[model samples]
Target: MIYLDDLLAATEGRRVGPSAPARFPAFCYNSRRLRPGELFVAVKTEGGDGHDYVADAVQGGAGGVLCQSPPTNPTVPCVVVPDTQLALFNWAAYALRKYDPQVVGVTGSTGKTDACQAIAAVLSTRHTVFRNPPGLS
Candidate 1:
């Protein structure tokens, strides 16, 4: 679990608004797929700024939000950082350090999906393996 304090320390962020969840099971940037108790990352991508959909994420049951700019009135807990994208990266690095997960990367023109699944299946028997979905890469 990713604790709120870890996020703050990793991203050098500050908490704002009401209370935040003590720990987050996962995070998501897409409001359409956000689950309850997950942190909504408001990243500014080429197509759109996630900050624009903060409310939508909250309405969809986001437990907390991470953003560069705090909204006027956020119903859920929020974390303010200098740069949301950078903060995300920093938090990722922090998690890697804390968990020390053995990272693996699979890349190929073909058969990558099957290879990843097979590898995850093998690893899961002895370790906690995190596999990225086919389209996610």
Candidate 2:
């Protein structure tokens, strides 16, 4: 499900912030959540640059970093692109194609966690179900 080529293509015309060497992502991550071997995407904010967290994300076990600029960490691999948010969307779309799993996106003002649990309970009867951490609620 790894699509390095697509990721590279998506990074075209991106800016290069201070970064480290190139590393492959073991997984995909949002700016707020990172995982080992994950590619962290840093979106620009009104106050500062998203690339600022590149170093921290790497320390958290991210395999690669996607930002407007290269990362400051020497060991972390980075891909520079023009827009981090767009890149994130592109990367996600690419991931969707690669993984092609039964996706269940949920959003609500209340009872979202309960709804998710209900769905998981129902699905578990027929298939293996993996639920998000309870704290996510």
Q: Considering every candidate listed, which one attains the maximal lDDT?
A: 1
RMSD of each: 2.3, 5.2
- Provide the lDDT at 35 for model 1: 83
Q: After superposition, which runs of candidate 1 have C-alpha atoms over 4 Å from their true positions?
A: 111-114, 121-127, 131-134
lDDT (10s digit) by residue, model 2, range 70-117: 755347556777787787667667666766768786787888888888
Q: How accurate is candidate 2 locally (lDDT)?
A: 0.64
Candidate 1: residue 130 Cα off by (Å): 3.9
- Native-to-model Cα distance after best TM-score fit, residue 83 in candidate 1, in Å: 2.0
Query: What stretches of model 2 exceed 4 Å from their correct place?
Result: 10-33, 97-99, 117-137
| Tens digits of lDDT, candidate 1, 1-137 | 66898998898898888876777778788999888888898998889999999999989998899999998887877999988989978988898999898998988798888888888899999997665545665
> What is the lDDT of every predicted structure here?
0.85, 0.64
